[model samples]
Target: MSQSDAARWEARYQAGTAAYAAQPSAFVLDWLPRLPRGRALDVACGLGATAIALAEAGFDVTAVDIAPTALARARTEAERRGVTVDWQCADLSDLRLPPAQYDLIVNIHYVNRDLTAQFAEALRPGGHVLFEQHLRWPTPVDGPGSDHFRLRPGELRHLLWQLDILHYAEGPFDGRDGERLALARAVGLKHH
Candidate 1:
């Protein structure tokens, strides 16, 4: 992401258009008990819902986002919830992660197909990746205009093909915001 893009996201956060659920999404919560508790990374962690939830669930967490304002808010919430998280601000477009460093990785909403490959590199042999995003089906109603930002049918599965896809779904889902959307979700586990 460019400085201009960062500035745009910063402005969005400042304008309060970046609001996200304070609680972690149900999909994420569902996989909590099934995942190993260890080093975790929350990619594009907007309000730190997943990050904080992981912390509370006894996982050491590091979260990243592009906007400082959003990170600040996430930090405050984490502290308020009595959880500690290492938060970093970085462009997801140019994201890189240390090899075999995480036991769990959660990415919700935000889409950066390029980063999917890195998830495998960042996870331990038994680590997992949980991802969900609006799909480009019947056209997006209120989302990025570019198909590049939306997942095409089976694209996510193809992206995580290297990993064992333990869970996968694609269809209309009632979003936490009460909007119905075509969505795709993947939960991949690394066995190597």
Candidate 2:
């Protein structure tokens, strides 16, 4: 992530009274009942919502983000919720995830296409990855308009093709902010 991009996210998190909801992503919640309690990683864990949920579910959770401001808020929330999460501040664009370290990985509303391979490598064998992100829509909504930040149609499936897909969905959906968005959601299991 660029310094400017990080600054932008910091500003957003700092300005809003509640930049993001305290609840976990819908996709995460949907799969939570089926996931094993184990070491989990939440990438770009803005506000640490999903991370907090994972911790509460008895998973040892680590949440990473580029913005220090966001991570700070996440830490405060985790403390308030009475759950421990390892909050890490790092730019995923350059950070190398540890190999075979996580049993479950949750990535929501963040797009780092370059990290797909690393995400697979970071998961232990038979581990699962739950990912959801905004897609390039016909008309711009409240998302980064660039193709670089948005996934193309069917792009995510192709990206994680090596893994066994447990579930996949793509289409317009209502966002937390009540805005309409084209999104892609998926769950992939690493081969054992």
Candidate 3:
């Protein structure tokens, strides 16, 4: 993406840090106990919820998002929580991370199907990726209006074909602001 993409997200995030939940997704909290502590990456980590949580859990963390405002807020919150996170601002919509550089990768409530292949490639052996995103459904919800932005049925499973899926679920979910969203959540482990 170009500077236009950053400007667009910057405009959205100008609305303030309340754009998403203040806490990490339930999926992240649930799987924290199962994941190994190591260097981690949080792609499009708006407001730093997941990134902060990972840091608090002792993972050397790097978080990236397009909006500087959001990253600012996230940095503040992470500091308030007394956790260290390397917050970076970038347009990861066309994300490409270093190969086998992280032990864990996290993506919450964001989609970049184009990045799935690189997701697995970015993880070291025995590493994991915890992902959750809105899915196409017949109901109005709190996510992208376009089907292209949401995962199709069974798409999450297929996207992580290079890894072993440790957990997966897709259905109506309670999201921020009591919105009923069809979400797909998955935990995939890379086994070399």
Error of 1 at 92 (Å): 1.8
Model 1: per-residue Cα lDDT over 1-192, one tens digit each = 789988998998899886764568689999899887899999988878889999999999999999999899999999998999999999998877889999999998888877887888888999999998878988456656777778988889998988999999998887677866788999999996
Candidate ordering by TM-score (highest first): 1, 2, 3
Which 10-residue span in candidate 3 carries the lowest summed lDDT?
15-24
Tell me model 3's lDDT, rounded to 2 decimals: 0.87
Between candidates 1 and 2, which one is better according to TM-score? 1
**Candidate 3 residue-wise lDDT, 100-156, digit = tens:** 999999988777777777888999999999999889998677777889789998999
Task: For each candidate, give its TM-score against the true structure.
Answer: 0.94, 0.93, 0.93
| lDDT (C-alpha, whole model) for all candidates | 0.87, 0.87, 0.87
lDDT of 2 at 47: 85
- Off-target runs (Cα >4 Å) in candidate 1 are 139-142
Q: For residues 98-171, what per-residue lDDT tens digits would candidate 2 score against the true structure?
A: 89999998888888877877888999998999999888888767666677778999998998887899999998
Please give the clash total of every predicted structure, in order: 0, 0, 0
